[model samples]
Target: MSRIGKQPVALPDGVTASVSGQTIEVKGPKATKSFTATDDVTLEVQDGVVVVTPRGKSKRARQQWGMTRTIVANLVHGAKDVFKKELEIRGVGYRAQMQGNTLKLNLGYSHDVDFDVPEGVTVTAPKPTELVVEGTDKQLVGQVAANIRDWRRPEPYKGKGIRYKGEYIFQKEGKKK
Candidate 1:
């Protein structure tokens, strides 16, 4: 038996989980997430807890069972608690602002970069340099944040660019005169 797969996932208050065929749906107060299990994996809900089991005894089945369970658990947690990513714009003139559903970034470039925020995600700028990304889906939120940060990634020379809050960029010493 797989260790992670054998463990039961406890459903939090105000969260609901349902299994139908190969699909699992998790509904929470904030949002809902759905996942489809592999052919060799089976999901069961017992006494408000979710259990994942493999259909047959095989190495591949064993490997997939635990992975599927963890993915489902993440989906449940994400729907309830959500996920967030914070970014900081460095440099003198670099800044970010929210214009309707789009994020406008001024990263010392002649033209401002505009990014359209996808559905199911929210972006907020508490400060001109600070950006907060929130969404129920962890993968989507992270990808969006990475895309934004890629516009002007922090450099090792001067470290003037966009980066995650609290992230450090190592500075290199200049050549001796």
Candidate 2:
């Protein structure tokens, strides 16, 4: 049995979850999110809580049990709260700024890199070196942050690049004289 899957997801005071067929829809004050489980798992809402169970004893069914439960829990939580990510740009000339819905990046490149913000996600630059990504959906927020970091990953030589706040870059020693 799955330990996490055994636990039902509790609905918040203002949140309500309804299951139709294999799809579970959760609505809260902030947003509404839904998830459709595979045939390997079954989902239901009972007594103000959402429960997930495996449809069979197979390995795939067992794996989907816990995974589906977590996804449902996330939906309930994310519906009411916003997920956030912080990024720090490191380099002498590297910086970031927002122009309307676009993110202008100067990552020591020949030309500036412009990233168009996607729907359902908000990207902000409080300081030239600091970036904040926020959204109701966790996956979209994280993906936006990752996409920005990929523009200029931290280098081992000088550790100059865009990286998550509090992230440590392993520095390498310089070549011998």
Candidate 3:
């Protein structure tokens, strides 16, 4: 039995969910999101909750069962509330700013790195060294943050780079004398 798959996803007061074949649509004040599960799983809305079940006892069906349920839950949560990811620039010269729809970054590179913000996600530079990514889709928000961090991943030498907020970097000993 799949623990997560067995749990019903409850719809909040202002949120509504609809089921059509393999697709489930969740609508809320913030946004509306839909997900289509594989044929190995079934989707249904009962009362104020959404349930997912396996179509068969096969291993693939069982795997899809839990994954489908979690996807539906994410749709519900995303429809009702936005997801956010924060990043911090740690190097001395590293910084970030928003120019129109682009994010201009100075990550100790010869040329400033220009990151074009996608349509669904919004990137904001609250401070010179702080960046906040927000969107209705959790995956998009996280992916954008990760892409920004990839430019200058935190290193152990001096921990100089871009990193998620509150992320810890284990510093290694400097070159032996």
> Of the candidates shown, which would achieve the greatest TM-score relative to the real structure?
3
Over 26-145, each residue of candidate 2 has an lDDT whose tens digit, in order, gives 999989998899999989888999989999899999999999999998898888788899999999999999999999999999999999999999999999999999988888999999
Worst 10 residues of 1 by lDDT: 71-80
Of 2 and 3, which scores higher on lDDT? 2
Which of the predicted structures, 1 or 2, would earn the higher TM-score when compared with the native? 2
Model 3 lDDT per residue over 1-177, tens place:
999999999999899998888888899999989888899999989999998989989999999999998888888899889999989898887889999999999988899999999988999898999999999998889898999999989999999999899999999999997
Winner of 1 and 3 under TM-score: 3
TM-score per candidate, chains pooled: 0.91, 0.96, 0.98
Q: Rank the candidates by TM-score, best first.
A: 3, 2, 1
Measured over all alpha carbons after superposition, the RMSD of each candidate to the real structure, in angstroms, is: 1.7, 1.0, 0.7
TM-score, candidate 3, is 0.98
Q: Candidates' lDDT values, in order?
A: 0.92, 0.94, 0.92
lDDT of 1 by residue, 1-177 (tens): 888998888899999999999999999998888999889989999998999999899988999999998888888889689889999998999999999999999998899999999998899999999999999898899999999999999988889999998998999877889
